[model samples]
Target: MARVDLNDYVYVNARVRGMRSHLLTRDFFMRLVEADGFEALHALLEQTIYRREANEAFLLNPVRPDYDQALTLNLIAAFRKILDAVGGEPRRLVATLLSRYDVQNIKSVLRGKHGDATASEITNILVPVGSLRLEQLEVLAGQREIRDVINTMHAQQIKYARPLIDAYPDFTKKDHDLAVLELALDKYFYRDAIGQLKGKGTNTEMVRQMLVGEVDMRNISTLVRIRGVRLDDGEVENLRIPGGALSADEFLHLDRLGDIVRIVSDYPDPRYRKVLQKALAEYQEVDLVAFDRELEHEMTRRGAAMSNLDVLSIGVIIGFMWQKNNEVINLRILLRGKAMDRPQAQIRSDLFFVEREEGQAA
Candidate 1:
């Protein structure tokens, strides 16, 4: 187990609070639209949240590669700073989130292989922020087959690699294997890491409850998508990740989606059902992206609510992290929208505002 000095919360929270003030707001997104191109975008970013990364990133060309490289470097640097501030076990705990980069790298490698992309092209797209270093990710990408990466992972005692190895035999092509491997890795990694954490005596249970709720929402989304694709019950079940708040019995009962509505309604927290109802209503007509965004916004609001409590625990840390990540994501969305010349309404629709009421309800 990684060592944790619980008393360090004072220093940790102070640093997080200071950093939180720098996050971009709705006003920032409004200003980003008028920027000309990548260069102007780069300038704006440098002036705002990414001053440090942008400065370092400018050492190279301001092309797409440099922009992405700087962004990735900036992200890892910020994440590591938080870890260092917290130190000890919290570092290891927060590090679990970076493990998602392994899944991201797997998807990128498979996509590149499918498209017959050059190693240079693939390397540029890969975001390095995981337990595995960039060199390690590059090595995996250069391997002749998935087994090479699996073998490397096995040698390293990466517990999450087993599912991918088991599913590899079923994969004849890159797309299927990447999808299956990614979904499996997400479940295995999060479950193992969250299960290890001591969540007692704090809003830990509340936050854990929120994570479990997210699993349920994700499961719902998966079911809807798979059903639309005309997949069979068995295939769908095989694809589903377990350990959500939903019971096996409840999930099995979801032969029809009305069961999902009922199940969500029965959740102990009333606001979840209220939000789900509104989101699902929109989802029935439009695409699920809106609903997905709503769910995330709701969860962020829930985390923010927990952060407001005077208690010292993982709640504020987790809440602040979500807010920070949201800031990054919202900026990316805004930048992409500006690049593509999307209308403000369309871009605004995609933004999920954290509601104080939703947080309080959580």
Candidate 2:
């Protein structure tokens, strides 16, 4: 009873809290955003915890600044450190959550292979924070044929390979559509993740809540993406992820959506309804920046609230992970914005920051 009261992830949370403390403040991001150029950005990054890897990244890619690669490498290293620190239930919970990255890694490989991108280019974009190690993904990325990639995964007994194999028939039928493989990977990940999360513990509940929100966000994004596209109902049916706050019926409503405002009006959660309102107001055809940015902010805010709630449980870990992710996102935007000579105002507009009060970390 005492340990239960203290929570399953008590010790892990302490370490995570320390890690979260190192997260950059909004003021730091402001300075980074306004930095003169890649040289100025490198000088500033050298002062932070990313200093070592950032320097290493620059040395490895001396011909280019490679801020994108530096930031991604740092993010991957941070997540791997946490995963290395824990065991038992805490480990399982964290690993399952991070499996989303596995989905991302696979999708990047498939897309790269389908699009004829070189292995190095594909490897540059991967973070390898999930079951798939960076080396494993690099090898997969090197495969000349998409079929070779899938076959290699099955040969190596990768857990995610089966669904991709099942989905490949559809891919061949549909003119090598990568979306089919991507959506199948998503469905497999959520099903497996949610299954692993089945329990009544506080940690399980909060993490499941986060998963639900993710499912809802992905479902809505899918609806929005396929709205004007030439996709069929069968295609849309496979896109709705199970285990979200929004119901299947609600998804059906969103799919038939004609009035743009109805998307904002119809969503059940007023929190996300407001977010949709913002996205809707700025909604442009095919450009997902406004929508993706707003939705990501809402998710980060949710993570922040959860982090504040369960000091000894999985909430803090999940929340900090998202914050760490936001750190990378913000840095990437700042780096790219400065590199491109985008205005300070424009770069600031693109960032999704945590809301802090009374000098507290969000």
lDDT of 1 by residue, 120-191 (tens): 777877767667777876776776665666787777776666877877766645445567667777677668
- Cα-based lDDT at residue 48, candidate 1: 76
Model 1, TM vs. native: 0.82
What is the model-wide C-alpha lDDT for candidate 2?
0.81
Question: Which residues of candidate 2, in runs, are more than 4 Å off?
Answer: 1-7, 228-235, 269-271, 284-287, 357-362
Q: What are the lDDT scores of the predictions, listed in order?
A: 0.65, 0.81
Question: Mind giving the per-residue lDDT tens digits that candidate 2 earns over 89-194?
Answer: 8888888888889888998899899889999999999989888888889889989999999999999899999999999999999999788898788888888888
Provide the global lDDT of candidate 1 against the true structure. Answer: 0.65
Q: In order, what is each prediction's RMSD in angstroms? A: 4.5, 3.2
How many clashing pairs per prediction, in order?
0, 0
Q: Estimate TM-scores for all models.
A: 0.82, 0.91
Off by over 4 Å in 1: 1-7, 36-42, 55-59, 62-66, 125-128, 173-177, 203-207, 228-233, 258-271, 355-362
